[model samples]
Target: MPFQAGLGTGKLAVSKVSASEWRARSHAAEQAGDLNGALEILEEGVAAWPDDAALANSAGNAAMRSRNFDSAIQFFGTAAKLQPRLLEFSLNLAISLSRIARYRDALAVLAPFTKEGFSVARYCSVRALAERGAGNLAEAGAWFEQCLTLDPKHARALHGRARLAMQRGERDAVSRYQQALQVTAGDAELWLGQAQAMAIAGDTAEARKIAELLMQQAPQWLDGLQFLAQLRLAAGEADFTSHYTIAMQRRPQDHNIPAAQCAVLAGLDFNREAAEFARSAREKFPHLERFALLEAVYASAAGENERAQSVWNTISLKNNDERIHLARHQLRRGETDKAAILLDLVLQEDPTSISAWALISVVWRLAGDPREKWLHEQQGLVAFLPLQDAENVLPPAIAQLHRLHDTSAQPLGQSLRGGTQTAALLFDRTEPEFAALRDAIGATIQDYQKALPQSDATNPRICHPVLRYRDVPWHMAGSWSVRLSGGAGDRHASHIHPLGIVSSALYCESPPDAAADLNGDPQAGWLELGRPPPDLGIDLQPITAFPPRPGHLALFPSTLYHGTRPFTQGRRLTVAFDVRPEKEPS
Candidate 1:
């Protein structure tokens, strides 16, 4: 191994004494906590001994730690090629590929290792994830079951099943998580997963308890503190500030907590405090773009548009580039024409910019484009027919849903605070009440799909419809009931479904005051659409407000911003779900 090694930016001498010297030196650097230094040493070693799989594998590990997935992929690929018998090398390569969203590539890498064996459970679970990522949910589910059959206690497989159950709005998610924890009670991640499942299942009180216990067990777990904060916020509790404080105290170096706190305060209209928090975070992590973005958001939320623009200008001018923040501000201010121009520039730079695509839809709508054209261009932007005859059939189902909510339900996902939600995936469950309601929804969806306008390849809504004729395959379904016993109900926040096409809220119960204005707010308890998130510092108004009426369903694009207005009194209950497109038969 006597050779001169090039370290990319420098050179290092390797001794013929042994190849182990380079690895030992790299190990020493890693032990001394100089991870970057270790990476550099490994790089030099790889350069000198190009054919050594061990050196390449070590380099790949270092690159993975550095978050250089592309470099890791290259190194791991080389290692796997050189050592075909080393399953670990192939697994590492596949994992790295998956990290970069190259699911097909990852699947290819793992193809040879998918046979039955003692170590096959990991392969099965990984393949499941890859299939899920590739939008083959059916295949993903099969692989997950395969993994469970091989190793029931497999942590990743169990977590995957739990996540799938959650996505499908299944009540059994909690049990699935509990089963996982039974096998590995000390796993903090498993505990967090259970907490999340509970939160999503509408058990915020229990979720908070679990989070608190997790924090006690792992004092430095920021996610636990964040979960507690989220649960408190969703419950509309007054003392939610302490969780953020505890989180910061646990790890002040983490800028995410401060950044998120600023957004929350801004959303609450605590502009002064939000601004202060943003400034503090900016001072602490001056180099991070996240805080600067937060500063701009705070300025915008405070109605200081000029200040917000100036902040964006400072950032863009310093970096000498066009920034999405500026375009977002334009959209927030209803300057669609300006936003269009800016977003075009953004698209040119990165055509796959989700935010840009999303904003373009809003801009087109605001600019008075036809619904068909705008919806088609936006993709994922469409409305379904409102359900009919719901007054007769819904009451019984509503009663059953409410009973579940009252007796055993938890609060809705932290996003829909102040509401208790049921856990059963309505369509999948066998309850007669749910089945009847599901039938109505399925019929309505079928009618909506049949009425959809014919289109060429250009019309995404028509071309990529999710409607299934023989069956209504909802990606996820659940019910949430918002009952404000003493005070105002908390509104659902503006957000998008990350894994859905058509999102809906079917009104099952509305308080007497739901249709009435509370303190001059006519939109109270109404489903609102098109408002940007408050934390983005843009104070855009809702474009549409669908009045809440029992037996009516408000269906809209999953990509659009939608939420409810907090009502002053009474209970509001609704069933919501995200639908995924069924794959075309081959």
Candidate 2:
């Protein structure tokens, strides 16, 4: 072929080459370990052969390999358009769309095939995934069932069904996972899912053993290592990072082991050690920006402000997450204005960011910005609803929760200290007591939503324009029970739920001391709202405090910081949940 000179050296004269030649050259570049170069060649080929479905599909595959889902979606869509009759092209387009969380679009692409009675297991499985991602759980389950009906041993469909069972708190989740594993025994994710199901079903010991075996088999498996660390931490083992240490010893050159170790340490609240370890890791792997960021965050948590700031100064903030951490650091140093600037920039880009909103509330409070009052101090924002039939509900609920608190220590990265939180989602459990409590809480949430102020765009809560409380879609993002053993300095740290629109604490049990008059020395076990974390060096006090009552729920904006006062004696049990809006205000 006669080639014309391209605009740049090393660039392919794609116009002069056939599609097959372009694919061949691209494959050669990929074999030479130049993925970017291969992708460039494929893109040029795509431009030259705009009408070629095969060439477009090849380019889409290249983009998918690069983890550029948007580019893959574009190319896959082009291919699907050019070859409307080809099932593979449409399937690829749908898969690419699902990868980027464009679930509705994915479903739209698959709709025609569904109408045409396409009975392939893969098609049904893909539709199930899209439906699941779109929060249509029942539809997802039906699709998965259809897939299983067509092909009983389809591994992907079985896996999807098992996952859905887990999410729904079904007792059969373990058996479903087992069924999936029977077909694909070598899948690490299936094994992990089975282990998780076991743990949720109150088989923590067995779960730990499975995780331990997995770690021994695959030293560099980050998920297995993290799961093992959580299991160890829950068991009150002092040396929870032992598996990580062993992994490092076995795979000395694996940078991911050290990185995961750093994250595990920080997540488990070993801030000082995490800071020191991350600094050392950065020294060894100076090219990893993640290590630098980890060092800065852990250093800040450890109260090593100077070291944190020094590390932050060296880092180029690449994302809003990094900027959020920088803003937090500034807030801790009492540099509210600087923190405000960073937070404003973040909110400008992602107005739905709960972290940014939470931090900005603090900034406004410190800088005397009136928006603080508009955000947190609005009337009816916080509600205390006394559950009906509290006397009947309390005993069984508390007893059921006590049985679920199998661990000796609190969970990693949670606000609770000197307490043990339940391992499984409370609402999803098969216990009848939990079901009753969930129903009661659901009714309380409806009442609370009804009482909320009219929709205001500036308000975080009730910002959605929908006026009917029942019409606005929402779901419980998380539900966990906490049992605090009093007299051991047991309390919750002041914090906000970054993923929730509305947060709640339902007091299932309260200590005798907690019920005492507030005139006493310490307002024992009282829930405190709007109190900034002590480490943040903010001089603010709790805007309000509530006495814990059995079967009573306190609902408030997730952006407001909340915690509890330490009591001298007895047990305090509570169920907490975060309510996530299905759609946020535009």
lDDT of 2 by residue, 425-495 (tens): 67766678877887778877888887777755674533321222224677776788888877788889888
Candidate 2 off by > 4 Å: 1-55, 82-87, 115-118, 386-409, 423-451, 454-473, 516-522, 568-571, 584-586
196-256 per-residue lDDT for model 1 (tens digits): 7877666767878888888666555656766676677666577665667676777778877
Clashing pairs in 1: 202-410, 202-411, 203-410
In model 2, what lDDT does residue 398 have? Answer: 82
TM-score for each prediction? 0.67, 0.84
Q: Where does candidate 2 have its weakest 10-residue lDDT segment?
A: 461-470
- Predict model 2's lDDT versus the native: 0.82
Model 1: lowest-lDDT 10 consecutive positions: 461-470
Q: How many clashing pairs does model 2 include?
A: 0
